[model samples]
Target: MARYARSERESLADLLLALGPDAPTIDEGWVARDLAAHLVIRDRRPDAGAGVILPPLRDYGERIRLAATRRPYPELVDQVRRPPWWSPVSNRLVDELTNTMEFYIHHEDLRRAQPDWQPRQLPAELQAALWRQVGPLARMSLRRVPGRLLVQSPGYGEFSAGSRGEVARLVGAPGELALFLFGRQRVARVQLVGSPALAERLRTARLGF
Candidate 1:
């Protein structure tokens, strides 16, 4: 069985090593070093990683992450390249379920910041997997949206989001829709249609996990 998450993790680690520490990523204020440290910390130190989404512990997590960033860049990337088997997020049983989208999105985060970047030709199965993962994300992110929001991926499937009113449609491939939903709207290539104002509002709204 193929594990796309492992492939993506290795590929991203390779790219980060090649790019060096100073390279920019789509993540605001994060360079290659910051991103590498993030991956390492997430896999190696579950306690610290938990704070990434928990406000109360976020400051402490940031401190630990900053410390990790201070280590040699090569060391950080090396850790990312070889996540321990015991890691909650990297263990074989949960790796694919938890990390496919995580690695893909972060891989793109690194790739898209460079010049003349293009989307990869992901396998249909992978696209379908991504589509399934994004539905719940769309629901959560757009739950409070002012108008009805529809996210559609041609030849795949569609998800209706938001709370009420007029409908706004966002159409794209699953990968593109994932990028859009993850707050990469400025760079994601997707068609937005419906009421102009509502569409714009949906486009401009803050999104992501």
Candidate 2:
């Protein structure tokens, strides 16, 4: 027989519960507040058991950029569930698996504000997922720019370091690194990897909310 949820899916809720009150979040976009609202609102909807909010649930990446360019933070947070988010062009069907992704995605945003940034100790499965996403993204990022160091985000334990010994260091708790790699630390700090360049790329990169 099939179960409604698997161990992997069940772990995400445990992960969310593990997050502290002060995780990193987007600065101008009410990223944390919106995430909080999403968690609260979506969970309440009996129809959507897992409360998945995919990137597709958001505005076109372009639209989010345009909106970020024009809107005030107060208004932006207020608009969380309205337009763009629920719009057909962006919303994608998702379940708990996708829901877990959202938690990681949004948590990264929150990590920026947290200086003593720490990625919660992920269960083995989620830890594995974090490892999988970081390398490809980091390699692609380095090709476009330059950074001569590697860091192990806290909590997850050190998995890999591309190369070592640069003038600067990529340092932070595991969650912070995970969040930064995923592009949410734009509004927060990932401690530092090498230069302001790392943070700058994160800020300038056209990552959508």
Candidate 3:
């Protein structure tokens, strides 16, 4: 099987190098170098990666990630491209399962941020893989949201998310839906359908980890 995770990681690394360290990304204040450092730290430094999900470790993780940015930009991109074999998340056995959507989303974080950038025509298999991730992502990110959310990717599938309330629907491709749920609502190409008030709220709600 093709390794989408590996492909996305390589592509992201290439873009980082091509754009140099100063290019902007969809990730708010982060530039290419910062995004590269984040990937390196998340993949290679388990102690700091914990901060991604653990509240108390967040400060420590940010410090480590920020420190990583001072390294040569190419070196940081290389670390992202070729993660250490011993790294927990990127180890051979689990890298596919853990990084497919992670790398894809971050890749787009860089790609979509550039002016005149357009979406890639992804392979159908890759789209299927991304679709599978939507459920868990929505469940996690929308748990606290105040209305019923119906997420639809025509030709793939659809599912309801969020806590119970009036129904609102988000329509987009699998990758776009993933981006929306990951807090890139401003950049994600999704259409909202429902009451104007509820739709606006969902669009602006804090999402992702």
Candidate 4:
């Protein structure tokens, strides 16, 4: 019943404002302002959002996103905080399913990019919610990874990905595993257990969408 998506969105907006527009984020070449613009475009601009996943619309999406960045930084963060009620992705009915992981991951993207940042002690319910998403994410991100990959979140569950070859295991809390699968491997606090070669391969493999 908790609206994790809303909470994460608000928290991320708060952090974005606190850090100012120039703060770095885990996303390459993007700063706090850029990330704020991205969130707004994602939430309010469905036509532009399509470019995020559709190759043909990419340039148009980039143009819209770049224009959004020209707005005042605080205004952009405010938009990220308060998505329009009619937003397709952030509407009350679908917001939880759609935005929970999206906001959580981006929240960490900003947090982990900062100096002296520490991992959060997430609520158990949120961890379970995140765990439920791990399997699908792993399947998509690791589909091309060589060898068998096992992802485990103690006290939650496990998921297997990749075709057979050597076996590799990724162990962490559900949130950490989610981060790893989302291509934040360098910042994700997960352990890889396998042959040295297998471990290295998993570590360096391009994971996430």
Candidate 5:
């Protein structure tokens, strides 16, 4: 995890760069713009004429992204060691960990938008960084497969086999779930086995912006 403030803007930026210019273009835009704007919201960057704005996702992601961008990583760590941005008001380590998770989670999200997308396992170092989120993402990734809730991923396994209560399926590689939750995507492309209400709820979970 980070010892600095806010989310991982560098990592998010790196991921957008990795997505390349040829990636899928959503009705809103390509994954690149979506990813960038999402992080921008987390950082609370002044909305200086960036065309269309994105919906809100999680504040933590935006915060870290902006914090990371203003200075070099070394400087960021220094900021963490100083005052104003660090205190009981906010534990530096905890904030860094969440920001790390946001980065790791969203990396997968943007990556999954491509037909050729594939996720390397969450890197051990990054995992160590966002280690706390594994359990939480695992639980959140699960969908109630048979109960009118189904999660379908492109190349991954089918979750729940369309039976039983809630299903925590990992159908479309982990990366898909990462981007999906990060709100880089619209749910229309993803089929839901449950009621329209369930789909609506998932759509509106609002991962910040």
Candidate 6:
């Protein structure tokens, strides 16, 4: 079976290597080397990865990530390219579940950072897969927004988000909307419609994890 996660993982690895360690990425304050180390720590260190989402463990996660970032760049990128088979996050059974969207998002984080970057034509299946992810993600990420949030991915489908007040509709491909909702607004090509002020508010609102 085709695995988008693995394909993205390998592609991202190759890109990082070609760009070298000093290249820029969409992640603020992180260059390619920093992003590479993040990937490694995220998958190989379950304890540290939890810190990515768990506030109490954030300090520990940051400590481990800092150590990983200190390793030689090439070596760090290689580890991201070929994760150990026995690894909890990289093992076959869990890899797809844990990494599909993770890799996709980070891959774009690299791609969109470059000056000449352009959106790739994604396969229908992959778009659908991405659509599925942004559904729940939009709900959670936009929960704090003071208006009704509707995310529309043309041809695939759409989902409702936010809790109350005026309704704001966001239109774009799944990948684009996902990036926008995740705070990649500078790079994500999405259209926001509804109240002008509220729309701007949603656009400028601190989004993503």
Best by TM-score: 3
Off by over 4 Å in 4: none
List, residue by residue over 1-209, the lDDT tens digit for candidate 3: 99999999999999999999999998889999999999999998899989989999999999999999999988888889999889899999998889999999999999999999988989999989999998999999998888899999999998998888799999998998999999999988889999999888888888888
Q: Which candidate model has the greater TM-score, 3 or 6?
A: 3
Q: What is the lDDT of residue 2 in candidate 3?
A: 98
For model 4, residues 1-209, the per-residue Cα lDDT tens digits are 79898899989989998999999999999999899999999999999998977999999999999999999988899899989999999999899888999999999999999999999999999999999888988998888888888888899988789888899899999899999988889999998999999888788888886
lDDT of 5 at 164: 55
Model 1 over residues 1-209: C-alpha lDDT tens digits? 77889889999999998889999998989999999999999999888998877988898888889999999998899999999999999999999888898998899999999989988999888888888888887887786678887888989988788887898889999988988987888888899999879878878888876
Overall lDDT per candidate, in order of appearance: 0.88, 0.45, 0.92, 0.92, 0.43, 0.88
For candidate 1, the lDDT comes to 0.88
- RMSD, every candidate, angstroms: 1.2, 9.7, 0.8, 1.1, 9.2, 1.2
Return the TM-score for each candidate structure: 0.95, 0.41, 0.98, 0.96, 0.41, 0.95
- By TM-score, the better pick of 3 and 4 is 3
Residue 174 in model 2: lDDT: 44
Candidate 5 RMSD computed on C-alpha atoms after optimal superposition onto the true structure: 9.2
Best by lDDT: 3
C-alpha displacement of 197 in model 5, angstroms? 17
* Alpha-carbon deviation at 166 in model 4, angstroms: 1.6
lDDT of 3 at 68: 98
User: How displaced is residue 55 in candidate 1, in Å?
Assistant: 1.1
Worst 10 residues of 2 by lDDT: 1-10
